[model samples]
Target chain A: MKQFFIKNRISLSVLIAFLIFTGISFFADYQPGKAISKEYFFQFFKEMIFFLPIMFVLIGLGDVWINRDKVEKHIGKDSGLKGIILVMLLSMAQVGPLYGAFPVTYLLWKKGASVRNIFIYIGAFCTIKIPMLTFEIGFLGWKFSLLRTLVSIPAIIIIGIVMEKMVGKKDFTIKQP
Target chain B: MKLLIAFSVIAIVISFIADKRKTFSGIKSGMVMFFKLLPVIISVLIVVSIVLFLIPQEMIIKYLGEESGLTGYIFAAITGSVALIPGFIAYPMAGMLVKSGVGYSVIAVFITTLMMVGIFTLPIEIRFFGRKVSLLRNLFFFIAAILIGLFISLFYNL
Candidate 1:
């Protein structure tokens, strides 16, 4: 119990603060604000519950089954433009909030995927995913959405390369827990 | 969601048949990852709720055109980083902002950063990528968001 509390102290305090604020809002008669906040909170919670398990399951399966050699060959240091295209396609296929991508990203790192490709995966996952694109087109017009996609492709690549360069040849380790 | 669940189910079934021990180990790692992430994710969501309470939806809408010149664009960018509206709602809101004479550039910046650069998800990101990479990732996207806005405005009048 003590170890758990110590490890999770930051989150516990934040949770407590949330409860206190909700209580204060309840007392101060600011019902609407508190209600809306709660509504949004539950909505996101629902999304997290829906996606996280399945996403992590898939990531774990990949961790066990996917060969490091394959990851290195496809998205590794010498993979070049093909790796870029591949990561973009991989990211586009995903459907979730950005947080869900992190585990998969970590898995790819452990499997020897290149830094640039990793960043590209993240950049593409967040921005140009297929489902989000259609919604954007439906609401913001196909032209706007297409233009954004067009602009995003090169921008994502550039940023990824820049990130790789900024971090230099140094590759840091993130322990698998 | 249905499609994802279906695929995961198929994958799990196949993996279990192929090698039960490996499958179980895979699932164990996944569960460990899930529990590790839950606290940070929950705390982040709670903080997000606080943001929603303070700013509210309408206030975000209002921020788009409240200031003149570059300040309005900056405000829109900052609001995009902070606000957590879903894409369905957010895209339509962008349309509304455009209709209300907010430039496409500002709207571009708003949506780009809104999706790519999550202020609320920073802690979760730090957990995976560390402080420097996460912060730099957001910073790069922030600058890219601005440039995306400029490019969109340059390419199309609408």
Candidate 2:
């Protein structure tokens, strides 16, 4: 039972937090803050509910079907510039939040994708996803959108390369679902 | 977004029909991951809510708009990293800020870090990439965001 509590402490803490917050809100006449926080929480959750499940399912399918050799050849150490471009393009095209991409990234890791490519995939995923870019362009203007993109490409790649240099040699523990 | 969800459903259906065993295994794995991720997601969402209520977007413009200097840019970047505001609302708020005379570079800094850095999502990121990689990635993005803002200012001026 103690081990169970330890394992589930994060969840239990959340429950505790929820009760305390509710008590404060109720006793202190803090209804507006509670209301606002609840609204924001649900909005975030709405995105996760709609998007994350599909991402996980798709990643699972990819895991089951995708061959390790193929992923390595395409995005592994020897994959080089071609690998970088592939990862970048794939990330750009995907439709989901950054957190949603984490499972896909872990799948890539399990399939022998290079550290550089994995980093590039994440960088591009957050930076260049097309729907958000269009929204960015609409609000910020084409020049702002275009210039940021041009500048970010190199920065993303550099981050990837530098990260590869840092933890590339470390053995990764493959945590199972 | 609705279309994306619909497409996912169709693909799931196709996969399920093609091979029940593979589909079940895929879904089971997905469910396992879903449960694993839920706690982290809830924690962040709750915190993001509290921050959103506390900060109140108006204070953002009031602070940065008045300064219009290095400090403002720094504040913008810091805010971007900390706040979990989505792009849709952020972009429109940014458009309003531009109208209200916040400089291009400051907005650029905010947007760059806003999209890239995720202090709110750090737990989930750590869960996936571990502590070392997650911190390194956020640090790299934070630095890159500031530089990108500077670059935009230079180019637009030139």
lDDT of 2 by residue, A44-64 (tens): 878878788878888888777
Candidate 2: Cα lDDT at A71:
90
> Which candidate number would show the highest DockQ if scored against the true structure?
1
TM-score of 1: 0.93
* TM-score of every model versus the real structure: 0.93, 0.93
What DockQ results for candidate 2? Answer: 0.62
List candidate 1 segments past 4 Å from native.
A1-4, A20-37, A174-177
lDDT of 1 by residue, B6-104 (tens): 999999999999999999999989888888788888899888876786776667777786765577667877888877777767888888887877777
Error of 2 at A117 (Å): 1.0
Interface RMSD of 1: 1.6
lDDT by residue (A99-168, candidate 1, tens digit) is 8888989998999989999999999997899988988888788888888999998999999999999973
The i-RMS of every model, in angstroms, reads 1.6, 1.9
**Interface root-mean-square deviation, candidate 2:** 1.9
Give a tens-digit lDDT track for model 2, residues B1-158: 87777877897888888898998898889877887777667777777887888788899878878876788878999999998888878999999999998888889889888888999898888887878888989999999889888988999789
